[model samples]
Target: MADNNLWHETLHDHFGQYFAVDNVLYHEKTDHQDLIIFENAAFGRVMALDGVVQTTERDEFIYHEMMTHVPLMAHGQAKHVLIIGGGDGAMLREVSRHRTIETITMVEIDAGVVSFCRQYLPNHNAGAYDDPRFTLVIDDGVNFVNQTTQTFDVIISDCNRPYWSRREPVHLGLLRRLQTLPESRRHFCGPKRGLLSAAG
Candidate 1:
């Protein structure tokens, strides 16, 4: 419940954010988490995962751009990228902007989230799902990273908050693994909220 029948996202003891809900766009539960997408008067559309606000439609570019570009730019000659957990496809959309990058493989834990966003929050991903250079892998990011024999020039993790996902160790372990890539210049991009999660 929210003021004027709007939708609310509260992060218990820390903070609360609200959106004017034009309508409940989509709501469903996938194997890994509950997903919600709704039209907001201010943000256009919003997506939340397991009650935690993940990303809003309006400011997504800031996150996506920095997440995709900074690392790619820093690594200058990156040809391959491995994105972990960007189920919404926004990061994929940003990454596809670079024509020099030949391939992008995105690993997400929930296919339902990808399916849900593609249908309802259609513009959020901006058709990145169907890009020829993109590949989607539905699996746990940690497991994917641990098991994959292939290496990438850049690795981006577009996951939600660690506290919300109960996977802090997995995220940290992935970072530790990134440090050990022996033969390649590996660059990493992950959530900014990870700093807060790490502190806790």
Candidate 2:
């Protein structure tokens, strides 16, 4: 019994140390949400939704600037933009920097993600969620893209490849819908562009 107790104590201590170094423990009591907090040295206490790290104090600018500037500079004069799967609103905050952008639409499937980001990751989004020019849609990104008759000057795919790949049917359906759009040019970011083209 003493040996078993010692082993259990060792295991507990190991797990506690791992959690202390790697993640911030947020007590999640909500019925429909996964809340996490990261004890990041630079970002301090960082809160995230659904186990996804939205941003850290150390590297938010790098991601925001890269995601925004690369495409905005490439297009040169984008007046409207569409973002698929960036529920964190970081991309929206970046897109708002360009004065040329008149409208920005963000489509994310999880409303919970958006709500959580608004509460936790305020620095990343910069309160762009409430902007009048920004339209937030809580729906399947593909369905949102398919039904829209309006074509954007630029479309930013801000989703993770692995997650989108897991939902192949939805991703493929969206690609097919995008092909039907009148726009001659389509630009895709992230790792799943090949799958997108295949679906198209």
Candidate 3:
């Protein structure tokens, strides 16, 4: 909540962080999540979903580049890439930088996240959304993986943590589905912290 000019992120009961808001750009409850975008002197623009910080303008390159480049570089001949739940467009931006990749498909559950982030967080996407190689699908990532007939050389999962209501981690479930792909080289990259495990 915005108290005075500061926005407090109570991600945990006992521990939280505060970012001084230079301006409150957008705040609303979308169909799938609560979204907020605000400007900060340090972070430039900050986006929070369900009261948890998701991305920032200032250092987005660090996370985006690492998650994108590391796996792509490792899978040297990757021509097709799939991304799950990167609604902010940062992942697309990084992935599109590769001239070798012929197709880039991103599946995001929330359309609203894409709408506002495109407007308020343009720097994150940087016109990657318009690239001819890109395709955006509004659907659940898990279901997309389970049903997709298409194949990808590299798959990146840039999603938020699993819902607290669910008993199992969503990444693990997605990983299981990824394994069913034909016996060939498949590279998978997920969130680096506690949320995901990399598989190749």
| lDDT values, one for every candidate | 0.74, 0.61, 0.82
C-alpha displacement of 51 in model 1, angstroms?
A: 0.6
lDDT of 3 by residue, 72-153 (tens): 8877777888888889999999999999989999999999999999999999999999999999999998998777777677
Give per-model TM-scores: 0.83, 0.67, 0.86
lDDT of 2 by residue, 1-200 (tens): 01221111122324411222244444363454565545555455454444434456567777768777787787676777888877777788888888778988888877766776677667768978877789988877777776666667667777633342245655556667656655443433221231221110
CA-RMSD of model 1:
5.1
lDDT of 1: 0.74
Candidate 1 lDDT over 1-200, as tens digits, reads: 43475767665669767777787778787888878887787887888887777788888887778878887887777777888888888888888889998888999888898888888777767888888989898888878876776657777877776354455655577877656755443423322211101111
Runs of candidate 2 with Cα error greater than 4 angstroms are 1-33, 45-54, 160-176, 180-200
Q: Residue 162 CA error for candidate 3 (Å)?
A: 6.8
Which regions of candidate 3 deviate over 4 angstroms?
A: 11-14, 162-167, 180-200
Candidate 3 backbone collisions, by pair: none
The lDDT leader among the candidates is: 3
Clashing pairs in 1: none
Model 2 lDDT on a 0 to 1 scale: 0.61
